[model samples]
Target: MAKYKVTMLKMGTLNGEKSNMTMGRNFGITTEIPMFSVAVEGNGHKIILDTGIKSLEWARVNLGEMYVIEQEEDETMEGALAHIGWKPEDVDIVINTHLHYDHCGSNHLFKNAKFYVQRAEWEAAFNPVENQQCFYFEELFGWSAVRYTSWKFLDGEAEILPGIKLIPFGGHSVGSQGVFIDTEDGVVCFAADTIGVLENLYENCLPNIMTNVEDGFKTFEIVRNNADFVIPGHDPVMKKYQTTDFPKVDKIR
Candidate 1:
């Protein structure tokens, strides 16, 4: 057992007045256009979650041409980590909420780390193309930086690793999922794109894209009702609720 420090590193931010697209049906009214990931430190190990989007070049051809991204802090992941006194290779584990381009583009950045992805997502992502607007594509592969990949094949409350539990939540994707960290601030669930933004917390619904909107709603309810800190997809409000409480996320100086 271990304790973790979770920080929302601002990977990129979308600057537009009408950021929320009219996502109809189940999901509705998303707020903010920010991409985030968590940095974990403690237990004599370093871990991070969801690498965030790639350079806008990849975004231009794939993740909707309208999805323009600007670097929030450093030019590259390595440079960004150095600002906080970490190295790309320092990360021991990289969690994949799902394989969407925006969420996993930087997966290769942590070259020496082992990747933990949901079995369903890993299967779906590598299989035939699913979405016409699929954020990830074959073009994004062949980086060769990921030393290894593992799957959470079996379910029923599995611990992804020490202090991190891979709870089940198949939304956004067939096996789209999230993480529950017994962090210093309590359990922080990384519901990647599972809930597009904080609004999903209140609405308790998901868009038609989700495999099962009801399941998505139920998943959201579970995370929102139980976790100490709920990390929603693309929500910028994380920067505010965060404090210098954990190691990787907290100030080292």
Candidate 2:
């Protein structure tokens, strides 16, 4: 196809400002994070990755429950789209990097769009014990328009549209995937929460947590080296990578 444009849409902000107790000592990790809704504008197709936060219903209901992390803000997928001058329905395809709450919760918002998921990820969320939340699988069902567009596990590289492709970076989750799209400027990869912050690269360290540590490290290097432009997950650095006013997305040589 012709040239394409990739834009990082800020969905909203999440307050992860609260401190978590690890080994009884107070760890000072900032809680508030910038949620994002990434888009790929190809010749005639548009593909989106990871629909940001859906709502705080789960946190509000399970306030004191363990594992119920509360977010400081409530920027739904719809709000992010509105801010970008687009509608949730305008997205042609949706990619769920993994089944994590923050990543896939907004899948419901794009009920009309075709869903693309890794085969292993879909099955992991499909099986009873393998699944975490019911909505993980339920949200994709009963929607007459929904379809398992492409399975990344079986099909290593599947182009989302023409220029938008899914890169399997497994191990973060069973089938945690990354997206690589060729834009008019250069190659941009939607690396969902893999090497979260720029620091995730500086030290060449894993997140201290992962489904598969070894695999995570290897895949991380590949992502870091391959993409001409890497848009990290959760961090606000995507749009703020360069000058504030100009927002120049510099291509790595």
Candidate 3:
């Protein structure tokens, strides 16, 4: 097995209703949500888990005031990559946990990398349900400049590399997946929207934004069973676990 080093790249932050992340709880509270892209390095390859949002202007014009999205000077895709001494072209693979605007917004940057997306996700992205339609932006991934040959659409669980795997569990969306990486300590699962915040997993609460609450809880168990350390999709606490000491202690069972 090839052990890899994982780094969480801060893409930006979103200010939104806490209920959006914790389901029925925190209905009247607002919070700052951190967005990230996981960088996995090892096995002589460099991979990016997600690509953050496009830009503040793009978000404002497309998403409006539903939430305030902001990216610091060092949080752009390029900036974040540079912070880790990486360039877009240097990326060997790019795997998207899902195609929501925030997760795939910077897809256009890594022209040299092979992109991996679930077959279901690729289909749903184009014909998403009414509510999720707002989060799927074609301009980001459907640009004329990107070649079709760059994509590898998966069907289910797949070990893309020696120790990196893709786990698909549609709940947050019609086709949301999570990335599993082998590390020195154990397996680390980048539980995307399926585990949007720590509360979702700890409290067994589904995010109100999910497409299927049942599937959301199943995904939670998936993380608990497989991951020694779990990283939530948009938790501010993620800042402390940029590397493999993830979550401070072993993930909650």
Q: Between prediction 1 and prediction 3, which has the larger TM-score?
A: 3
Tens-digit per-residue lDDT, 39-156, candidate 1: 7777877887777766766666565655556774463455557766789878888777777776777776776677777666666666734552455554443335354343235344
Query: What does candidate 2 score on TM?
Result: 0.76
Q: Number of the top candidate by lDDT? A: 3
1-253: candidate 3 lDDT, tens digit per residue: 8999999998899998989998778988889988988899999999998898988888989899788987888788898888889999999899889899899998888879999989898888888889888888878777452467999889999999999989887689887888889999988889878888877888788877879878887888878887888888899988822785676323555
TM-score of candidate 1 against the unseen true structure: 0.81
Q: Arrange candidates by TM-score, highest first: which order?
A: 3, 1, 2
Clashes of 1: 2
TM-score (all chains, Cα) for each model: 0.81, 0.76, 0.95
**Better candidate number, 2 or 3, judged by TM-score:** 3
Candidate 2 lDDT over 1-253, as tens digits, reads: 6656666766555554322211122255656566666766667666677765556674455323333343332256665566556687787777777666567667776756777777777666656343345325345432432444432343566775676777778545667788877766666777776655545554555553355777777776677666666676766556621211212223231
Cα miss at 141, model 1 (Å)? 5.4
Decreasing lDDT order of the candidates: 3, 1, 2
